[model samples]
Target: MSETLLQLRNVGKRFGDHVVLKDINLDIAKGEVVCVIGPSGSGKSTLLRCINFIAPPEEGEVIFEGRTWKRFHSAFNFIANRKYEAKLPTLRAEIGMVFQHFNVFPHMTAIENVVLGLTKVRGNTRNVAREIAERSLRQVGLGDKLDQYPEKLSGGQKQRVAIARALALNPKVMLFDEVTSALDPELVTGILDEMRRLASDGMTMVVVTHEMNFAFQVATRIVFMDAGRIVTIGTPEEIRNTTEPRARAFLSSILG
Candidate 1:
């Protein structure tokens, strides 16, 4: 059995008085692909952000690689607590994220974008980082587009480059926050195909997606969320055949 890579316990978050996540608990195993699905405003993306510390949780423990940590505001309230601050860089490095909008730098070439973090954050030398960057791009089938800037690429290509950037970090886990949502309908399939390939190759992933077909085909487990809470979780087949009323209703609305 795969080891557990991440564990969330009693995780809660709020924006002002509005609760975005309520006492959420989840475990992500190594090399497992868990896809999250829900209606809009269900807090799926916010949950992903919390995991990666883009939006720190107001309450709860997030355990990554056996280290339990909490994100808390400091007394000054302008920054995260000092104890947690030291761990942020290492934690962020191990978790790669691809956002809804392709956040690739427009000024950098595809390879440059991939190499930047490796050289700067990971402290790899330029030559070493460039080699890894090129290999990552090739892995995503963007080998020929290394010199192209984000503006010059198609939406699908840009997303692929974004994936390559994340892969270059060699993260233990990858987070996808509706990565294909910003693309054209025709462009969505290419990105989804790449993700399917990643899952097949045993990359651990947590995806917040509206693409049910992709979820059904690629996810080892599916989590259904509603109103900022998890309604149910099951294997894809179980989700498809769920008897729970809310699950059935949700599946009906989406599958129609």
Candidate 2:
């Protein structure tokens, strides 16, 4: 496998006339944990979406594990590009996403939720899926909650189940979009702790979060964004001690 797990060059996204991301460039290496931070509407989440092609970029290219996709001109000239359609599913399978809201099925047990993707998407047998689900749940500390439904699980536990669902696929990269934002303050650390464990186990992760503590502690690199562009990219210590005015102000506003 390539050491460079994912790369984006000059990626851009727009909604009608409004630009959500512009000239964004990023590289995520294997086993790296990168935390992205910025104020609302700063393109933090949009960058991750572009990485997974959930919302493909309008310009530039995305290269993942040696496969490449480029944006091109269309007859309508509307930022439309149609390339790599066949490989998209395979690309997406290697990159997993966990949303802020725990989007678990109301009727399914924790194990069942984790196994759905394995059986449905990956074509695994029920027995095989259950084994993977059980192991994944254990990884997230939800072993005891396997048979419990989402409604019976706490916010943190539900989020763990969601994480387990993603883990069952064994994605090469995990994208977490503010996974702790909707949880109760007390439950937030549980999810953060799970993330920390994953990082220690060498999972490559791109996390868009407001949890500065988690970012400071676990991130191999921190990316600061503003106005749809990355303003600063550094290690935790470099970011904390940055003298750049915009970076300083943003850090002070959040850290202090």
Candidate 3:
């Protein structure tokens, strides 16, 4: 069996008085594609953000690559926890993320956008960055659109560029938060196809998506969340044949 690449131990999150994620625990093995499915405002995105420390959990340990990063008790302690903060750069570099919105820089060409991280974060030379960026873009089937700016590309193309940008970082795991949600219906399949290709290549991925068909085919495990907690987690076959009342009702509503 593959090793656990990432884990959330009793993770919790809140916004003022509103609780979002509650005591969420999950384990993502190497090369495992775990899809998180839930209705709107179920904290799927928040969970991913916590993994990347974009939204640090108020109470929990984010164990990635065997290192445990914990939340500080007080706001002042949060910043004072330099030991944990010091690891953020390396952790962020090792875990790539793609959001629902294609956040490519508008002025930069697709190639330029992909090269930014290699040059800026990893500090690779511009020439070396371009070489790696070219390969990454090609991997996403965007070699011909290398010079195209975001404004010139379709919604699907823009998302591909985002994926390629993340790929260039050579992350250990990839987190995708509803990456196809903003695309047109026809464009959704293209993005999902690219994702399937990534999974085929043994890329460990954690995706939060609503497309049940894509989830059924791509996910090694399906996690159903509701009211700030995981309701059920099972294999695609088990999920499809579940008898649990809450799981059945939720699946019926979404898949029907």
Candidate 4:
């Protein structure tokens, strides 16, 4: 048991009368790679969002590095709301999130896009930001494409730039939301390779992915979710041998 870096206790969320996640409890330890996998509508992506407060869990505590977020009040009473807002900047700074689409700015070059977070969020000087951005881009194998605009880059390159933008922030844990789904088939391998490398380097990661092979190869543990709840948590081999019906059926569908 490594030290827990993030904890979600009894997390729950809903939109109108529809429940997306319910009583979800999970703990991620430092340097662990956890891959979340499930059928569409299983709330895998929403789980990641809740963890970062993008769409906060309506009922739960998001504890990161030992700090707890105030309980959510729908109307967000002033003092409680202010407390949440007050911590957003610092909390978000420690969580790096890469989305399904390449969310890079079209107008900015790769290096500039990566530098933006460093300068704006972390308050680094331009020269300092640039150096950090350059290093991050190079880390994701985009060194030669640093000055290229989004329009000039391939889908794979654009995704790398998005990754560099997140990496430049030096987050405690990286959240990947179906990162390779938007890429063309040929480009998926490159992105997965970079992720595998990240796992090998002991960067804590929580990934929502449909790529079973990648999950098998890189995940320290696999979380199987169904109908807004965690069906089971297991290592790749355990998942493959699971007796739980939903998980068994899901794997059969994927493996077959």
Any runs in candidate 4 off by more than 4 Å, and if so which?
A: 71-83
The reply for model 2, stretches above 4 Å from the true place, is 71-86
The 10-residue segment of model 3 with minimum total lDDT is: 71-80
Predicted candidate 1 versus true structure: per-residue lDDT over 20-138, tens digit per residue: 99988999999999999999999999999889888888899899999987876767855456666766888999999998998999999999999999998899999999999999999
lDDT of 4 by residue, 91-170 (tens): 88899999999889999999999998999999999999999999999999898998999999998999999988998999
Score every model by TM-score.
0.95, 0.92, 0.95, 0.96
lDDT of 3 by residue, 1-256 (tens): 5798899999999999999999899999999999999888999999999999988999888999899987664457756677667767887998899989988899999999999999998999999999999999998889999999999999999999999999999999999999999999999998999999999999999999999999999999999898889888999999999898888988899878
lDDT of candidate 2 over 14-107, digit per residue (tens): 9999999999888989999999998888999889988888888898889988888764446764433334455577778888899889888889
lDDT of each candidate versus the true structure: 0.92, 0.90, 0.92, 0.92
> For candidate 3, what is the TM-score?
0.95
Candidates, ranked, TM-score = 4, 1, 3, 2
Candidate 3 clashes between residue pairs 3 or more apart in a chain or in different chains: none
The true-versus-predicted C-alpha distance at residue 186 of model 4, in Å, is: 0.6
Question: CA lDDT of 84 in candidate 2?
Answer: 48
